[model samples]
Structures are given as C-alpha cells and as structure tokens.
Target: MTTSTTTPLQRWKTFFADRSSVVSGIITLVVVVLTLISYTGFLQAVERRSGVVFVDSIHRILGPIDVTWPTFVVLYASLILALGVLLTRPEHLFRTLRAYSILVGIRVICMALLPLDPPMTTIPLHDPFVALFTSSEHSTLTKDLFFSGHTATLALLALSMPTRSLRIVFILSTTALATFTVLQHVHYTVDVIVAPMAALLAFVLNRGFAAENQ
Candidate 1:
C-alpha cells in the first residue's frame, strides 16, 4: 500500500501576519483595554464628585432609554465581539480597530476634559419618560453636552461597516433612538447632535491614518 502524504497548509495561517497588521492589532488591543479601564475610573470619579449614592437615579435616566435597550445591547455586543474575532486575523482587523481605538480614546479624553452635569439635575420625573433632570447627589465624569454615547455607539457601529448602505441604516436607526432620548427628556438636544459629529470625526481620522500608512 502506498502512503498518502498530506500537504502542509501554511499559507492560510500566514495570511494576516504581516508586520503592519501585527503592530496595528497590538496597538488596538492596548488602546481598547486601557481606555476601558480609564473610562470606568472616570465614571467612578464623577460619582464621587456628585455625592449622590442612590442607584435609583441611574435607573431613572436609563429607564426611558430602555425602550430600545435590548436592541442596543445586542448590537453593541455584536460589534465588540466582531472586533475581537477580526483581531484574530490582524491583516483584516488592524487598521479598522486602530481607527476605532482612536475614537474611543478621543471620546474619553473629551469627556474627562469637559465633564457635564446630566439633565437629571433639573428634570423631574412624573412618569418614566417624562422625568426631567433630577438632582444627583454625585456628579458624573462627563457633562450632558459635547457627545452622546448612545448616538456615538450607534454611529460607531454604522461607521464600522465598510459598505455605505449599512452605515446609512445605522445612522437612521440611531437617529430614531436619539429622537426617543430627546422626547423622553433623557438627553439634551446638544448631546444628540454631538454624537453623530463625534462618529464622523472617527471616520475621518481612520481614513487619514490608513492613507498615511499606505
């Protein structure tokens, strides 16, 4: 009987192992982890400053937004997981992730530098949706203006898509979400407007970086 020899499949493994890809992946992961830690710390500091300790305040602001909470959670989780998977293949993931990392870092920095008081300070909630800003015992890390996480998160998801159609869909869907947040008085008008711009800034930064490297 003749022995059959199995050819080695080395090319597939080598596909994403280029120098740029590896460097970019490492940078992205470092940024993601560090930024998250910093973000949590920032929020904690905000809480400390505000002096409010009741968890109900958190729920009050969030309850109205919960109208689409499940959807947001699923979408956000998928985006993050997708990034992780892409990282496994650095060649495909590096540039994109790097760009996103920049966005995240930028947002955090902006928030830290300009912490805003949330609307809860002034609005009173007669109902779940109608709750205006209530006074918080503790201050938050960031102010209510300069950006909107919901909008930015939605926009980030949209911008992550390479195709135009998906981006447009994300923009539209997030717009609706933003509208709901405003109608419910969860966010100020400025916050909703700023979110999209922040996302756009990310897109431009990513493109510029990619071009510079190429």
Candidate 2:
C-alpha cells in the first residue's frame, strides 16, 4: 500500500478542482448576485412598499452622526479585509462561500416577510451599491428593513472565517457596523440585535452540511 500526504495548497487545489466544490462556488456566486439584484429591486420600489413609520428611541438619544460616508467606507473595507484573510487560507473558501449563500437566502426571506419604514430621522446611509439603483444620491431607503444586512454579513464573516484573530476582527467589525447603523438611524434596534442570531444559525447549519459532505 502506498500513502501520499497532500500539502495544504494541494488539498485546497484538489477541493477546488472537485466537481462538487466548483458547483458550490458557482451556486454561491449565482445566489449572491441574484440576491443582490432581488434585494435592490425591492428597495427600488420602497416608495410603494407598505410600512408604518417607526420611531426609534435609540436614534433619539444618540442623535445620528453625519458620518454616513465614513461608516460606509469602514463597512466595505472590513469586508474586503476579511476576504483577504480568508483568501490567504484557500482551505476555508468553499465552507465560507456555502455559509454566505445561506446567509443571503435567509436575508431574502426575512426581507420578504417583514416590511419596515425607515426611522424618520435616518442620516441617509450613503451606500454606493444602493445609490446605483436610486434616482437621487441621497435617497434614503425607508423599506427593506426586516433586519440589518450589513450586520448580518459581518456576523457571517466572523462565524465563517477559520482563524481566531480573523474572527475577533470580524466580530469587532460587526459590532461597529451594528452601532453605526443604529446611531445613523439606518436600522431599527431590533434589526441589528437579531441579525447575528440569524447569521449564527445559518453558519451552524452550513457547517453541519459541509461536515456531512466531507
């Protein structure tokens, strides 16, 4: 009998080369892209969406900061950095993608199930992606407020990343985003609070499925 030990890179290459892994990656990408399109389409019609005006007391006390641009930059920058960390270890790629796909699916369902009017005092979140679909640069999306997608995404990154250090960074990043969203009156307090629980559930479920695949 002959036994061969595969290097980490070799293992990752083999996994990526596998039909199932490739399919998973492709599916994840498709889900992400489609989810974005669907979510944005929903947002574009927020003007007609049925939602009651919500008065967020948290935004009342904190008083929104005029840091929408800075917060947006930080959120996207942290996500990019987290991806860089994961890319350094190719072994983590597929599992992370699988978890992310589930996160997107959950978010889509949540958005459909819950309709929300943005807090009246919203600071006008300046997200470029959201801006692309809006007629005006400062158009505040008063709907699609079931949960905090930004917070959930960071929570997903924190849960899916392989290293403890990466996890901590992502967690702090998630916390920052949660705070920023509330301070900016971009999301209701409950939306930010409940996002991580949903992300964690998706992460756990995806982990079990990946283990079964192995």
Global lDDT of each candidate = 0.56, 0.75
Q: How far is candidate 2 from the true structure (C-alpha RMSD, Å)?
A: 3.8
Across 105-156, the per-residue lDDT of candidate 1 in tens digits comes to 6676766666665565333212321122222432322243346666776776
What would the TM-scores of all predictions be? 0.64, 0.83
Q: How well does candidate 1 score on lDDT at residue 70?
A: 42
Where does candidate 2 stray beyond 4 Å?
A: 1-12, 132-140, 212-214
Residue-level lDDT tens digits of model 2 in 1-214: 1113555566667767788877877776787777667756666766576776767777779967766876777788887897776665554766677777787678768877776778877766757766776667235565657688789989998887766887898898889888888887888888999899989988999989878878
lDDT of 2 at 5: 56
lDDT for model 2, please.
0.75
Clashes of each: 18, 0
Displacement of the residue 61 alpha carbon in candidate 1, Å: 18
Scored by lDDT, model 1 comes in at 0.56
